[model samples]
Target: MRGVRVLFCYLILAGSVSAQNIESLLMAGDRSAYNEIMSALQRKDFIEAIIGLNSFIPGYSSYGDLYFIRGVARMQLNDVEGARKDFILAKASGYKEENINFFISKEYLVGRLLKDLKMEIKLDSLREYRPVIESRDTIQGALRPERTCFDVYFYNLTVKILPESKSIQGSNTIFFRTTADTRIIQIDLFPRYTITSLKRDGKDLIYTRNYGGIFIDFGEIIPAGKMEEITIEYSGIPIVAPKPPWNGGFVWEQEKKRYNVGVACEHLGASSWWPNKDHLSDKPDSMIINLQVPYGYQGISNGNLRSQTDVGSGYNNFEWFVSYPINNYNVTIYMGDFVNFSEEFTNNSGKYRIDYYVLPKNLKKAREYYTQTKDVIGIFEKAFGEYPFRTDGVGLVEAPFEGMEHQGAIAIGGEYGKSNNRRDYWTKDYDYLVIHELAHEWWGNAVAIGDMADAWINEGFGTYSEFLFAEEKFGYPEYIRVAASNFSSILNIWPIVGERNINSNTFLGGDIYNKGAAMLNNLRCIINNDSLFKRIIKDFYLKNIYRIVTTDDFIRHVRDYTNTDYTGFFNKFLYETDPPVLSCSYSIDRKNNLTFNYRWTRVGPDFSMPFCIAVNNKEYIRLNGTSFPQTFSYENVNSFFLPNEYRYEKELVPPNSFTYYWTTWPF
Candidate 1:
């Protein structure tokens, strides 16, 4: 009877592995098992999952894959020591399948778990070059009849091209979920391309090809909400040609003395060559990047550079992968003749190296200029928790424009001489642009947003961080003055509503970056508890690590942790487009009192707010009104000249046509 029981167990395990649904078995390993483990976690069956994993992991190498899985599981179980041990083992064991994501994430997650800021942990901080050929292909499985949610996965790809337009495409599968009756996959395809054809589940499917993307009608609604996998094959000129964002062939203009190039496909540029969901709300699990570039040019993408082989006919294939979940916009590529170097840094967090890939000519100047990068990195790690992506060092890609905050790699448009050219850092402090972009490794890259609406969460916070760095490295007064300057700009550009004209992308420059930063600074002042505020910021990052968040989501998080309601706070600024301007005056009275009479005219119709009024810089009182007249008095004879300072913030409910005017007793 015992032998029969053992035989039955063996059969069940075999069937599970064959079906590729060994989630139950993998669970025994740890939280790191696989995506299958995520569900078991939701149900709170952690211990059982661990047992199954321990018994089912193939070959169960205690050092590499097996140990990595164990560490992930241990983390979920709150076993920090065990998780750390497993992660270290996995890192040493060469767990490179997920772009070494397991190794890097472990370093990031453990920081919050231990709250040990002084601990020095390091990962490669490198600059990336331009992507030669990029691809993001999605496969939607046939949905089950009753399924309300369906999983969609796209392979992140980096491709290379042969001399005759022949291409080699490499991609990794990314998993996600959708609830729309039929998924509207929006791919960012800039500059346009040609679609050869497409297939669904091994069968040719009719597709509609346009500049935006090639959409295929799956024919019929989803049945049983089951799964269906769709594959597409197409090719085109590199979206970001040698000239950049829009140039077609390959020819550098000698007169320009530089390449007129840019890869500004943040958010929606991926579809310029491939098909995708195009938005931030739906992020992919893991992806593979494959590229085929002209024999002489090197192609680079999101993950660690894996292999480069000559494919003949003037074509070379390069492949990369991102093992961890990455935002759609964070996906990138770099290509050109470049020199690569790696250096090491040892600190409390661990010993890691920084890498830099720059134009060969700028080697000496690059070294001298970027020396402080390591120290600034150390400071950010202590503050923001951990670096977001894999790969070390920074990639200084040559661009025709300015710098961009690419994960792990930042593309620099200028040479080393520009470092001391008076335009280096915006405030003449430390390298503000460098520090600002690096901070995004934590805020924008690690703790991402659900949509562009919360772009302020990324840019605003990043800009604020720049100021904070200025304050710390420069001085507090500089910081205060910076904040005031931003506030003043916001006041000038006060829109009656948050509605920005898409045609005019410039609106975001002031409102999103400057105004948003000022509002955050003001909130910090009001909160007053630096210790508590700092913890809240840290907690926010830790809680949402590795996932994309939204503005409402951010507000809710502040609401939950701060034990305070920020609904009013956000409603007043972010929700309302128009800000109120105060106008009022007062007269002296015989009863040792000053009679104040004031009428307010808002910037818009729906204007309503509460503000502070100061007289002679001595007496401060609160005034309230909304597009109407109100009068109040101060009990105490004031100075011969009553200097009234009107201090107020905008409310969120104002309409597009709103404006304000103020009149007082003295007038």
Candidate 2:
């Protein structure tokens, strides 16, 4: 509240309100009234301030600063609607957009106030204002009893894309094995679609629709260990994506005259357009996708393209088959007037095919630009074992939006340019979109997460792969420089892991990508053995290929591999929002000898991490920091430099070799 009052005073004195206007309105007597209102606001007496402003506003109706102050008071009183109106009025009355927008944007307002005002507001307390989870989200995100009774093994989907009308008609034949005897089961599809028929062995079945859940009754108790199949016939217009990949839906666009169609549904449930068990826990062992599109356009999906056959007048069916277990959301389709090209990647493991699908206009550029894929793949293979889907072959499709890691058919966008030009360290030109999505082929597609809460495993590893790529392609100096740039983006407002069993959008933030990668890098510094760290990552990927895993599974694996327990490390970085703080104090004796005391703060009792420091700005030393204080003395030292503070000076120490905020007392 004091900061709010100071901002108001600055705005008034800095010409947001002209002296002529204030002088005319105040008339040398009413100035004290305005001062009283601001004093009330400074005291956190919002009600008194609002009352004073109510009387003062009618006299000086054109004063935008007055409206701005009233808006702040209204917001403090939880009158958001009234505050919004006052903010708009302030802008219309000539208040600077930059100043008013600080109160208008919710995310910026909360973050700024939390910092400048030093408010005693916990981020957890803000959860009460978050969007409430509805019944539909529960049915789609949770593994209820109805969904847990059956395990899906395969999916045979046939769909026809009518891009002219922006609609689709499809049928999915689900093959599942019953784990428990039950007379009913649940399948999910958006309620907007019409279910023409639900059948088992060509006989109609009884079912009821509730939101996205379609509960079907079989009329008889299916015995345990029984395999059954059901084909659901449905058709509808899928939701159009306002902003793709982030807003999960279908993208229907036109490249000149030809239609470009694709769908991405990572956060948005797959049930938005298809019928299946939408939860993440159940991934089909294999899949067959048949997409029928206009004869001139090519239809693409995950895995290998088996065949393209003319089905009828003006249409052709492109059949695809996936041989390994796949996440439901990773299943996708792309349709456009595309030109195809291929190359063979021969490595020590074996030979594999890499396919590129691009618009006919960019075929020549794509051929030259996409050659880097081979080198990237080779780097990943050397670091984390061979590619996971050797049999299916790798595919990259040009997408309308940024990018998405759709199993084998990765989406590539960003206009095929270097994505991180904001940092001067990027001396090489490379497509970050391609590298990031390709990395997902190993981290997200092959080694998947069972619940969205553990999305850090998918995105964190994918982002870290970029660091690995930098080390191999550009050298270690470039890698450390880029890692420093990546670490600067961490918000640390929320924990990397979120609550399970609900469809949470926490992974949409940069923390999951930046902070998660930083956490892994810190772990490497703690292990202090580069070869062993690489071995641990490679073994983890090899062991869990084509499998669903959780954060706990990774913790257990690391514990067994290194013979050292890092449970407290993971708990501090993943489950908590604040990073550990390193507290230090130093004193120089009369003889110029330096004595330093350092320890960790704002961490658990069991937390301890080793970080490097430069003594006397010359020699390097590594010290283990714990909750308890430890001291180190150096003779005739001039200065001590902590690596965490001077990260850009890479020659002195490596950047992000450890993770912590640092504070030091005067000598």
Candidate 3:
């Protein structure tokens, strides 16, 4: 019955595809594109890669994959403008998830804008006219066939973390495509860490060092083509500790004490600690994290609390297993004096628990802040499908910055600390950030996007969830105010894709979080009916659980459920540079026909937008970009100005357009 329902919905919009056909298409598409791009990259013919990517973008605009690959190629060839254009196109295309959009936007903003010193200086200094012309010539390249397969399988990873001197050592891992053969395997590890030993599937093996890391020739490639696992063992202190990207090793702050921080391989930082395949193509079934920390400090990792054994002589061994599939980077650890609070709750799904773990000193404060977690959980479960993970529950770990939806264990730290009395604190609330991170369990952790390219599925939706929580708690007006504040933050805009820092993207500058939320609200407006929209939300969560969806996937869901043809939706908002500017005017004429002219001022480039215009106690519909200055006649009306009231949200600001329509009320 469920399958029938899903098929019916699929047929309504995109038309149903046979499972076998979809598999064949998906595999063909992925393999062909991957082979072409990889070959181009290998030959260092980034120009050809860009051309191939350009040819690919039109067909897969819904998926940011083509644009992202284009951006990578442009970056490789030092074509900043070309890269920026592709990334902006990708961002505008609107992938199913926010991560991809945000990632593309970040890449354009940082990678392109900051490509050189002069442009970087101008952008940093907020120059009046920034250059945005593509300097690279268009190159012709071969087009690859598209694949539509959606196979579920696993890859094997064997990592060995060794210690160098007392402070640091080298570590590496071998990644095998399948469980069979196990001979031709790829290895990526830190060179600083001395390779004391090497192994392949428990047997000793030899490896060759590569530029970035080490590569192990897995005699020949194996094809398990199913969930597979590989184990590796070695000993060495982490070589020259990783700082920015990878968050592992030791960082000792004099006042803060000796703390063991773990940010493992996030974004592209996995190679800093261990050698492994850091790509997003294949995800492991489950992971076993074992840390042998020096006797004193405790090791905290993701997943259920397994066990900690004191190995005696001031050494302890911590073994944790995340039965759930997680990304290479999501695996993290924090070793410090920690206090824990645990509670259980029963929901329609099943029995689950919520745990708040914090430093002993902040336990009291942590409880006070997280007191409403149970309520928050209840609210989300009703909206998004069931929480993805069960065993580990929700654990809040301390961090230096804001919060991270670190799968089962969320990292919460100083980002939520209160300043002066909690009543008069800045932002007046810290729980909002906590709520944002917690909601990610469903949006990001559970129903994760295939790649970071669709980050909006995680951050934008997660950020929007903050506003949703605000609406539920404070009411509509408060939600509007919060949304407005968030929108106000995106004063300037730039493309972001494949940018270096996920942290910077998460805590983005301007008003990305808020403005991004506003964008979703705008989307809600387009798909007005709450019942239908809410149903779409519910259905999206239910169907997309544990699956990586691209922007096209989301659009398919929305269009199918609502029976709306919104093919132009992404072209207007996600892909373009303009926001709609509204000009309002209304007046009762001699014939008692109230005249209203709502002119649209193109903001960035131009965007077709739909908005409601209220005039003289009645709301009138106005499609801003659909036509130039749309005129409306009301049968009876006294007087109305550009805007009947000051209640109009000034979110979509115009670039250089003005309003000159005369109205009786204004004159």
Residue 69 lDDT in candidate 3: 56
lDDT of 1 by residue, 124-207 (tens): 222011011122212111112222244445565545443344222333233334454553333334334544445556677665
Candidate 1, 260: how far from true, in Å?
Answer: 8.5
Q: Model 3, residue 452: displacement in angstroms?
A: 2.6
Q: lDDT of each model, Cα atoms only? A: 0.49, 0.76, 0.50
TM-score of 2: 0.80
Give the worst 10-residue stretch by lDDT in candidate 3.
1-10
Q: For each candidate, what TM-score against the reference?
A: 0.61, 0.80, 0.65
Name the better of 1 and 2 by lDDT: 2
Q: Which stretches of candidate 2 lie over 4 Å from their true place?
A: 1-131, 418-429, 587-593, 614-621, 635-641, 654-656, 660-667
- Model 2, residue 106: what's the lDDT? 47
> Model 3: how far is 660 from its true place, Å?
22
**Number of clashes recorded per candidate:** 84, 0, 66
